[model samples]
Target chain A: MAKRQLLLLSSSQLHGYEFLEFASRDITDFLSKNKVSTVLFVPFAIKDHNAYLKKVEKPLNQWGFKVEGIHNQENPVDAVEKAEAIFIGGGNTFRLLKALYDTKLVTAIRTRVLEEGVPYMGASAGTNVATRSINTTNDMPIVYPPSFEALKLVPFNINPHYIDAEPNSKHKGETREDRIRQYLEEKDSCTVLGLREGALLHVEGYNAVLKGFTGAKLFVRDQEPVEMKIGEDVSYLFKDCA
Target chain B: MAKRQLLLLSSSQLHGYEFLEFASRDITDFLSKNKVSTVLFVPFAIKDHNAYLKKVEKPLNQWGFKVEGIHNQENPVDAVEKAEAIFIGGGNTFRLLKALYDTKLVTAIRTRVLEEGVPYMGASAGTNVATRSINTTNDMPIVYPPSFEALKLVPFNINPHYIDAEPNSKHKGETREDRIRQYLEEKDSCTVLGLREGALLHVEGYNAVLKGFTGAKLFVRDQEPVEMKIGEDVSYLFKDCA
Candidate 1:
């Protein structure tokens, strides 16, 4: 059987954030361009397009695949089990988590990606769901109920938009760099991907590639955050760590 | 012997934030209108006229007491130790840390504070420096020498401004709430404070009181963040646990 492919995008806009994106054209064309034929999954948008089913449909339609907003009672396992792929877009993590909990689709999605090995793709919240815990997200905690454990795709955390500390700040309070440093003071073992917007960790089977540049930094709470560039020696964390 | 009185301000005017001042007009005047009849010593503000000094000078100077900044490198210890009130003004925490480290005044300040029983008032950086470690700061990480052992005034981490979540972003990146949730997950023993600008935690000996209305929220990274407003109970923590 061919190894399942998982594409995790932090944001839909693919280009401009050098070393953050693999391609720069249309998202749907980008997906189809990669020869990904179909995707069966819900659009987990929460903030800007939290309810953006149109964007999801546009991409899936352009790729000649049928997309549906899988309701909890829709038997997601059946819908996604035989699907070519499951692409989950980003939005509000809290909202997405609520939908997952309400619809009971988290388990089904996890099963589809892990057991059946159907390719799982997510952007933003979707990317967050693929990890062990969604605690690394830079989103708000406005809504709370389901808690922060993600799909556990990778047993680590992702601090997307991995920005370092500038000497001064435009905001008055703590900067992103300071907050992450503080977080690291506690968590020493977990890996934190301080991915600049376009940066990504492409994992397939037991191998993970740094598709972007080498200056991107990674932080594991309680430890020092370091930089990583493309082609650096890195393998998929999940397959080997597990 | 008159003990050193320490005044710790949150941040400088350069940054768009001023803790009590920004929170309300009353807070600024309340802090500034205090009178001091007796002679006092302030060892930190010699080099600059930060907001703390600028705001409080009218009242303090009215008392006929001299307001002096302790910038003499010859022996900062003498000034710090003899001061009536040691005021720590707010600025880039990194800059503060850098000065403290460079001057090697951290030790003297700690000694004057704990051993001498110096009556100290800390604003922004002052408040941050009072923590076990200022890693939770959202400002620039200009200095990361790791001073986890703070003044031990409070028992939890502080996330100032207390922004819940931005209405933008569509990724799975960690939000401020998620960070605290994860912190709580790792260490439930410690409490995290999401203090709003106006809110101040008054630590009078064993009692920790929440002053002002803008109260604070609580979170343990990887879990949910909760708002703990005024008229609520509070507690402290140990470094081993945090």
Candidate 2:
């Protein structure tokens, strides 16, 4: 099989950065190097369709690629099968996964990306569904999908926008780290890649790498979280993870 | 049905307060008026059994109530059925809900509290599950339960530990308000009560009131969030909520 190409981003924009500014260059290069002309965009995560499309168009247009919202097409599955590349935007994970499942596009997208090697780029909630299950998401469960299962494009799960606790804050809610630790206790076999903002996991077939301006935290069941330096090899996450 | 008696707390402890200190007075008063002796404690949310039981025993004992862990009982359903009062502690909501389903205790607890007039007290995750569903919880999914449907003791959903966005922070993730807004968009009929820390909602039959040190924000579908006074009546939540 052709090496699977996936760019799973923690978020669309980092602190003080313009929309998609942090990952714009990487995204543009990914599309350009592949000689892609148009990319199919999944905007199901956000409720506002016009605003999401407008924001996505400007950046991708600057990168010399045409973008179309899948929701506008006659058949979303057909569109995915024929798309040169696919981009899923960020918003609510439950809504996004439900949309994907509702339209029967999960299998179509998985086949295109994993089997046919179509380029897949997603941010935030979009990045979450690229994993085995949406169980590790930080978003509210505003809506329940058919199941917690996702595309299963990757072996383990991804916790996007992984942030540490506020040092001086006295809030009683559990920190992001504590929530993930509880997740590990329930799911011992699955590993969770805590992708901090401004970082991403890049998968090229069997080899996956931690990339971008910042590092990420890797959490496995029963083990302390290990920090992955930028550019560090994370291919092991793909091993025995699925 | 007997008048429903429930104490849905946002958290067990606030900063600079002992365990259950913030709500200790109200708790003791409620139990005392009911003439309750031994209370059954549901500690399924946390993984550590001993630690949870130890922490709970201290505070309830101070109030002259004997606390027993429901997990230690041979029949959890029978224990809840016979209990004078039930206290569910805070932790991961998903785990707690899943455990309740796995052990078939959801029905037993509901019957005990709703029919038998046994007082139901819960903090954080426990509070989340007392409503129609656990969709408004802040904790990560972590694990999948049989369903997101929760104990329908209350008409509307309770979002515990509900804090506003950091004023000057650079975090790009959605704020608590933004998330609740999205939830309303999807669930227009349901009302969400954002109970801030150091606050709680006390339900007595068809009447519910916001009590404690701080006010709460009520989010209804397509309406601006209304700020509820600390002692304001919230019986409206029980009206059309279901």
User: What is the DockQ for all candidates, taken in turn?
Assistant: 0.07, 0.87
Give lDDT: candidate 2, residue A237.
81
lDDT of each: 0.55, 0.89
Worst 10 residues of 1 chain B by lDDT: B1-10
Interface RMSDs of all predictions? 9.9, 0.8
- Residue B177 error, candidate 2, Å: 0.5
Candidate 1 residues B1-242, lDDT tens each?
A: 12323322333322354433443433333334444223233323222444445555554455344566555325776767666556565544544655666677777867766667555666566666665555455443322333434444445566555556655654334566655554343322256677665566655344455665567776654455567777564644233233
Candidate 1 residues lying further than 4 Å off, grouped into runs, are A1-4, A14-36, A47-51, A63-65, A71-73, A187-189, A212-215, A221-223, A236-242, B1-242
Candidate 1, residues A114-219, lDDT tens digits: the string is 6666777777777777876665565543244254676776766666566556565344565566555544543223566766666666666556666643235776
Which candidate number maximizes TM-score? Answer: 2
Over B1-242, each residue of candidate 2 has an lDDT whose tens digit, in order, gives 44699989999979889889998888988889888899899999999977999999998898899999998999999898789899999999999999999999989988888887889999999999988899899999988888888988887888999898889988889999999988988944399999999998888888888898877999988899989889899887767675
lDDT of 2 at A223: 89
Query: What share of the reference contacts is kept in model 2?
Result: 0.89
Locate the minimum summed-lDDT window of 10 residues in model 2 chain A.
A181-190
Q: Candidate 2, residues A79-131: lDDT per residue as tens digits?
A: 99899999999999999999999999999999999999999999999999999
